[model samples]
Target: MRLMRKSRRARFWMSVVVAFVILSFLLSIVSYVWAAVDEVFVLSIDGAIDPAVASYIERGFKEAESVGARAVLLEINTPGGAVDSALRIRNRMDESPLQTIVLVKHSALSAGSLIALAGDVLVMRPGSTIGAAEPRWVIPGSEPRPVDAKTLSAWKAEMEGTASAHGRDARIAAGMVDVDMEIEGVKSRGELLTLTAEQARELGMCDAVQGTRQQALKFCGLGSCSQNEVNMGAAEHMARVMTNPLVAGLFLMVGIALLVIEFFTLGWGIPGTLGLICIGLFFGGHLVAGLAGWESVVLFLLGVVLLLLEILVVPGFGIPGIAGLVALGVSVFLAVGSVEQALITLAIAGVGAVLLVILALRFIEKRNYWPRFILMDRQSSQEGYTSRETGYDRYVGQQGEALTVLRPSGTALIDGERLDVVSEGDFVEPGQKVRIVKVEGLRIVVRPEK
Candidate 1:
């Protein structure tokens, strides 16, 4: 009985140990699953808010939404970008179903502030500033001019609508974009008040003035929210490369030069192919960046076609050429975001075209003159007749009258025999009297016979 009792006790202890081990294993799996399910996504916007940033944000939000992200944090630190691009990003944000939060870790000025206002919630760090959302025209060699009243009104409506949807004060947001605006008591006598974090809070411009992402997440009832960063992809990288000003300028130069060469040589071969490709790339990149619309592309293509016709079909540069040049200039100006950029691009393209033309002319002149100067013997044919015993020997010293204008080569009657002759030095009129000086290899050299 004693041995049986001891065996029972040992069996009971073994069962307890097995139960404890299974419970610990189950807890480990549960903890891992919970941690995996509670991750939050973070996307950074650290540069100017260009088309690339818009694309990145749109794609990131779509991806996060697909994965059922708890929240998406946009860490914004930008000055601004093209107005069109900012508007596009704002529209995307307003339509997105994901919980979007804009965390102004640093300054979000100009268009950047407009984008931030589009977010569902706005969070700002200590000492972080916002609200310089006015639109200004950037002109070369001059101070930026404020947008006109109509443009300002449109921008105000856009900002106000976006702010109102997010539970922020629309009037205050509108004031941020218009310099002449003054919120009733916010400004002193003749003093314009740019709202700080505290002022924004009092004016209902921002949701909260937080110090860190953790505090932001906690306030949103996501205390255990994890962070994930969305990085640039291959497409984004390619977009950036194509948008570079140096690259765009290089493409413009190569395209124009190739087209010019095609016009002059070989009647459209490899040069034409390369020219079309480069021009296509230039316009395609601008189109994707939202800087160029379909209208600009059509104008550009029409200009190219007109220019081609002027160079290849027309007798000389005239109305067609001038019109084509004007159209091309307008197209190029519309392709760039700002007038300053357009002018700079035009200057570079013009300089490049001049340089290329000079080089091509030199090349053609060298090809024409090099053989006559250095390789004269090799150029002469062995089977060609000479003046010593040629049938044209009787034509020497014969008086003739040029039938065609003789700049260098013309038609002249030599002893009643119509012959192809070259003027000696002076340009001879069509009816000018000429004397045959030499005849070699069917070439009749003539001189003006006083």
Candidate 2:
């Protein structure tokens, strides 16, 4: 009986030990898996670089840092973009905490190339080309002119500073900006060279020529590193699309159409409200996108003022209206990237306005021909027509004295009956005797009795 009890106690102790060991092993596995699942955030930059792209990149960096990402890989494939926007993006990248690696999948010419040099590490594909970043202006009707010496020098300094920050050959980076630059022991005699992946590695411009992201990760001492794709959601994607210049231009056209319809209808209602909202959204998007500055806003306001003058003070759509449109067009062009986009927007707005005007005119004509345009329980009395209760049977021939200065519209007293009247083309001073010349549509037309 003593041996049986001792055996039972030993079996219980052994089972406890085995269970503890299994639990410890399972915890170790979970910890290992957690460590291995560390992520690297990716930011893909394709096509022309702009404020939209810059914003996207900046936002991506913030998110990566928030999630404790291991690193950020900026996959670059751009022709170029606005210089100011590029500089802003470069400055942001320089200030970022996470390690930034620019992966040149196909190419990184011009502004794209500048962005790559700003990265902590640059990875390129074997057959990819990079460089030719000289600044040139695309003047209308002429070939692109090389930027002036002063501009070139400033840009070269900026490029060199950015390159040196990332432990790159600053001189080579500067050469990319000034095509006339030549560095000794770097390029063959008189050879205008754009760096290929192999040449970039030889010149220490790129760390490695990798065929795929996996290879890039391995080469960067992250052989076991895992990755998570950082992507924009559906709402973010739609926001980005609406912020585009083309989409904003379309909105402007729709707004103009609504405004034209409201103008012809002679009342402020649904069309006017929709027009105001659309225009507000159009300007708001541009403002948020950083494409439009305060200058554009000021110009747009000035144009509005001029257009009001054309409508109220002037008789025809002459100088004021034309000038207003011109100012508005110039403002819009300056707010966008290029002249082509501006012209496209103008064409669309014009077509939409014409169609809206035609529709409005037809509606007005139909209303004039058809009675009961607006359903009403009672018909309103006509203006300038005397009611039978007034006892003014002989008022049409009786003279009246102007009670107030009739600079187009004021009050008059005829036979002790006060009346609101408007002068026809001439000013009528107070105390002047006036005659009721005509009566039409609630307006009493009066003139000075000669």
Candidate 1 has its poorest 10 consecutive residues by lDDT at 370-379
- Candidate 1: the clashing residue pairs are none
lDDT of 1 at 441: 59
Q: Tell me the spans in candidate 2 whose CA falls farther than 4 Å from its real position.
A: 1-37, 136-153, 180-193, 239-247, 266-277, 280-284, 287-436, 446-450
Candidate 2: lDDT of 169? 88
Report every candidate's CA lDDT.
0.77, 0.76
What ranges in model 1 sit over 4 Å off? 1-39, 140-142, 188-193, 234-251, 258-281, 287-306, 317-352, 355-450
Candidate 2, residues 139-246, lDDT tens digits: the string is 334576777899788878887898888888888887777766678876543444478999899989888899998888887876577776666545445445555555
**Candidate no. 2 TM-score:** 0.64
